[model samples]
Target: MATDAAQPSLLLPEAGGGLLAALDIGGTKIAGALVDGGGTVRRRARRPTPAGGDTAVLGAALDVLTELTTHQEWRSVAALGIGSAGPVDIAAGTVSPVNIPAWRGFPIVERVRAHPAVAGLPVVLCGDAVAMTAAEHWIGAARGYRNALCMVVSTGVGAGLVLDNAVRSGPTGNAGHLGHITVDLLGEPCVCGSRGCVEQLASGTSITRHAVAQGWQPDEGPADAAAVAVSARRGHPVALAAFDSAARALAAGIAAVATLVEIEVAVIGGGVAEAADVLFPPLRDHLAGYATLPFAAGVRVERAALRGDAGLVGAAAIAGAATAGAR
Candidate 1:
């Protein structure tokens, strides 16, 4: 890795070319990075995710990456890695992101390849959850764990599984979508057409919806569930109840996964988990009630170490890992 201090850009060393270029396109943001072999992002840029049909979203992502690649220092990057909302078609280099409806069945790899800077470089696409897990394994919270689950409990719930020290991407590269697991047969309807799914009952959106229905009003805009966490911090009964409801549902989901996989740890992240102190205690207690076995009882639940940058860093890890494996 070489740094150009004057330019605030990174130059990844290639056998003959340069550094690695990574892109992370999520439902909320698009971030690009230049990473070294050790997974440190030498250069980074981010922009809010644009909402629209597929073309508009792809254009937004391209605009962000194009701006990042404009820095002369990133011109010679060797590869590009993409981490996006899944059910991605890894074999076909396409994706049908759950959050971005327009991207359904879009040829993402080809679209990214069209970018001038990354045109010929090897590009690897992966589910965002899997990418997040890879980032944690590469340099974040789950580094020491051979079997861990990294999950996001934000606008929507999603997860990636790492088993036996390996990131798991089952057929179609869309494994470990834990949020869809049904915890309550009669629970709320999910966007995925499932009822009582973990995401339906425990996601940030669900929490806020639950609170608003209980007569809680957020002082800030949008009545975001994040604000409900703020209200809970002030001991608002409505907000606390909202969180408790989410926790109970999430705990059931966790216990079910632990029962099936015997995962060693659960690394939780996303906007909702910011209130870890308020949320985790109840979640742990609920989980205790759900799990009957020792393994499930010992399954430690922790926080995701990486913030928003986890996706980009994870993309870099995937690119670097794939490059190494190929060699």
Candidate 2:
């Protein structure tokens, strides 16, 4: 396992040699950035993710990276960090993202290291959730919290843990996969081979699906989470119920995390979180009912502070930490 001499900043002691090249890979898009110790993106690029096949997926990521290298600041890059959709095995540096079907146990680290422009740079790989945790701990909402759960509830659910002031990825770099944790023992079967996982209820895609199935029609149109949120705001019964149910499921998962790991806070982000008025109230309500133990009762829930760049920032944080530790 890799370790960093983490402080509030979570950067190396020297802190001046170079920037970090960070990649955030997901089903919809591949993003790359040049970031520094201060969580600033000096250069950035993005491309549509080609979920068609293994080569297309990797090529999209490479396209972003190649464009990033063209930036004059590329010379200052110290190391590379990838926060990917996973099932990532840090021990093996392989990834099998459920969303990216073509890449099963893909050897990402070796492939990235083989890239000509980045040949000698160290590559650190972790789940997107783990990277999100690192970002929150270093420069966002969870920065001052000694123990917290950082989650991204978007098209799918992703999360990570910060324990005793350090980002923890567990053995497989998939520790805080709150999405897959079973909330309903016998509810709908999920893509992760589980029944009633938090993702099955709380993710934006799931929320929209549930809303549509419940006959929540958007006069504006049927689209996605945004449509659901708009309908929920209008007090549509089915849409409201959909949000409430998802909130409850998320609360169950969050409570489980708090009860089991004893976190002081839960930091939430992503598309689903945008419906804060609809989501947070019921989330806290259900959370109260579930997190009954004195130890877990006081866990605070808050929105993410990093906004759109959390994943990229988190990736950069991991890269900064790993390269610093190596030095």
Candidate 3:
């Protein structure tokens, strides 16, 4: 268990250095950043994700913290926040990520708090989408909007909802798993044991699958979405079609969410979002077809302005806000 000072200060406030350490745990990488109270990243580091086991992942996180705090200028970290892949048990400080089997039932919060460098710091946990949404609200695309949705499209699709100036973390902190939504009852299987999920049809992985099915052979055989995007730009018909499939699938998910929540804007992020023109135009067109209701119409679809660090920054925001609330 974390020490008293490290506990969430929901009732009592403490005045001290407000440096916050934020970590974003992804399937392929573990990214960390040291953020000041004002939400500026002071230092950043990353490591290829460890596939061996959860312990190895924790080791990598500790190694990152050691590197960041060892630098003389960053010793005043006041809290730690982790924005991790869901579904996470925020109250329990545990994670059972659907994609990372090794993380099932892992006590991530305790493991992180046990680190010597940050043992006495308040710690908060949130799903990646929610954290990213918080980051966007703080300094990214949703900067001025109190009601918005931040969605990420990469290896998989996920989202975070913000309404009335607060992130809706929902019960168990897995509120925004848009990727798992069923887009096609006959689609491919997802890592979550679901068939025909939005991720199965629209994720980068799906783009690769569609391209392969179209008989577009890559130099090394089956290629990922990024490779397909490059091929599409270079006049590969199959690749272009794959992009269209992904856009349509994603648009379906976005339309569903937009119609349900009526958010003011939906900020899309993640690796695949880099193919902005190839992806967004199709998404907008597809969405326009389905957004017939007045409430859902006029919902803007924009790119996430936080770049790749949105998760980390959002984690810091969660921790900072939680700590302040505890105060």
Task: Please report, in order, the local distance difference test score of every candidate based on alpha carbons.
Answer: 0.80, 0.86, 0.80
lDDT of 3: 0.80
Give, for candidate 1, the lowest lDDT window spanning 10 residues: 1-10
TM-score of each: 0.92, 0.94, 0.91
Listed per model in order, the count of residue pairs whose N, CA or C atoms clash below 3 Å is: 2, 0, 5
Residue pairs with backbone atoms closer than 3 Å in model 3 (clashes): 9-326, 9-327, 10-326, 11-326, 12-327
lDDT of 2 at 321: 78
Residue range 208-323, candidate 1, lDDT tens digits: 99999999998877788779989999999999999998999888988888888888788888888898977898898898899779877777888889966677777777776676
Against the true structure, what is every candidate's RMSD?
5.6, 3.2, 5.9
**Model 3 ranges with Cα > 4 A deviation:** 1-17, 219-222
Candidate 3: tens digits of C-alpha lDDT, residues 191-271: 888888888888787888889988987765447887888888887889889988888887777778878887778899998
Candidate No. with top TM-score = 2
Decreasing TM-score order of the candidates = 2, 1, 3
